[model samples]
Target: MATAPTASNLPLFYKDLVPLSSVDHADFHARPLDSADFLINQHAVPLTSDEFVSASRHYPIVFSAGDNPVPLALMGLNEGINTFVSEEGKLINPVYVPAYIRRYPFMLARLRPDTDELSLCFDPTSGAIGKFDEGDVLFVDGKPSDAVNNILEFCKNFEEAGQRTGQFVEELQKADLLMDGEVSIQADGYEQPFVYRGFKMVDETKLRELRGDVLRKMMQNGILALIFAHLFSLQLMREIFAEQVKAGKMPAVTVAPTTA
Candidate 1:
């Protein structure tokens, strides 16, 4: 599973980022996405902690393997395979799309590395923002239009949710609750169980052994609910695997050579 982009790494689905400006794009209008083809091959998408409750219902919410692990919603068991999305970029299953996907083509990003200030930016290659005659206007009379204001509001909310997500991950790390994750599925007629790895998850064993006060505090603060949501979502892994099989995207089995 792939993690979200860092300062040095390019964000998924974005080829190039440019700050949105009223001056440079007075006549530009942001068009609604016509298709979800961009997500057709994306098996996993980043998730903010605030999205756990909603996203967990449809996709398995697991963490990336690293020191600062971020949450991710798995759409398929294997890389570059998305069973939920169709060839035409439509959803085969009417599932709750992650905010990370909804926020695509537009996001609030830092313009400089030294400062904390953020600017509204969009992916130029997205083809969503353009000088169209009929679409949401970006600017009017040298000022940002209502549409731009709305986008800014959404981006701000996303940023705030991202910060909260970071805090939730920190709490898990502090409690030593995260561990390397693995899932084993034995499909019918298969001699070997398919083992999947390369991700992380909350260690329920450690969680159950937490001290009374820590558990109480976590419960009161709503952290326990998130952990349970993640654990419950893990069951859907088999469902996704089944979907992949039905879609004919399941990887072929490799039988090891047996010595005489």
Candidate 2:
């Protein structure tokens, strides 16, 4: 979820934020971009529960270790190595690109601490928006253009989905279903297996032992499918490790995963 914007703690990929204004940015336009150089060294991205189904197909959906854990999509098992994306940030293959990635440069954020209202903001350093000669215009006749409107709508939907995701995680925590996660990948001719940790996952035993009524409620509310999606995606952890080894980015026999 997009959170408060500040000088010291800008979110991943954002260098600075400025609220979009029709008067100030009347001539600014957005250009098409096919790459994200910012994601080069990032191993994990914030994922919403709504993305569990699609993201589960490409990345292992797991929880961060903390009191208020959020879902994350693991792009790689080792540090600074993303298997699906190239070193330059062009996606290496066709995969489910996360909305968090797609929403780059544009996100809903509160502009002031005194107000509860959120404003449309963009990372000015991205270079994706400017007074470009070609590409989508941000404003027309002092009103937001269709392209800008679409971006706002997408950001709004992302924030809404974040709320639902928080509720789902709260349920998991209340049920005591999350546990520290561990995975060991043994490469050929190696005596010791590579151990990866620093993440959390659902406790399958606890999930199976949930009361029937609770399970029924989860199913009725679509939480059951999301949980299963996360559980099923964990199998991809080894696949990611193999990819890291193939790319020569794997650590020496054993190593822990990057906590970030």
Candidate 3:
């Protein structure tokens, strides 16, 4: 029998997830968000396989019919918003986010390319979220009447926040830090002639079929591979922690872990 990989061996475990070649913007459009589509369509994600197994094995919160069902629009919007606050952190400094990433444990997040025009999916059986570059922006998973306007508003916010994040990451790229890296940035939000420090940000809206082009490239390279990897890592982290507890390697926490 083979021994399972542990946290100590996690660096090797995740090494395979990295691309053998540089992941360029062109490649991202083709792949269009790695494993995220499998877990949930552009419209909905019921529960992951691991989530289902975990839920079946443990008790979770239950509600009555009178209780309101969780709004999918809110769920989706909240996901983006949470990522913004977490990854970008109010844009205090263009360099803060990347600096934080190097100093601490942070979750990874990805948004499909703006040009793809793909949005929302809902199959009670297999929910997903992706781009639809060919069509006018439409929320298909649920009724646009139900979540379309909401998601559009969220999309606008997402674009704005993404630009800010890009600015932050750009600063990191210019820094001398040993771990400095370039974040995947899509020129989707830059509109109007905006000049900062004598450099003009390209107007993404003017690019014909740019979002679709970006989406196509992403699909080729493995869409949102890093984000999905982080999600899977969370699951692995739990498994490793549980195993460590069983082996009496560390004490369990009664209070929540402190955060900065």
**Tens-place lDDT digits, model 1, residues 1-260:** 75456455778777788999878888899898888888988888989989999998899998887677889899987777898998998888788989888888999989999999999999988988888888898888999899889889988999999999999999999999999888889988788888877789999999999999999999999999999999999999999999988998876643211111
lDDT of 3: 0.24
User: Candidates 2 and 3: which is better by TM-score?
Assistant: 2
Off by over 4 Å in 3: 1-125, 128-146, 178-260
Q: What are the per-residue Cα lDDT tens digits for candidate 2 across 106-141?
A: 999998899989999999989899888988999999
Clashing pairs in 1: none
- Residue 147's lDDT within candidate 2 is 97
True-vs-predicted CA distance for residue 106, candidate 3, Å: 23
Q: State how far residue 20 of model 3 sits from its true place (Å).
A: 34
lDDT for model 2 comes to 0.86
TM of each candidate vs. truth: 0.94, 0.95, 0.22
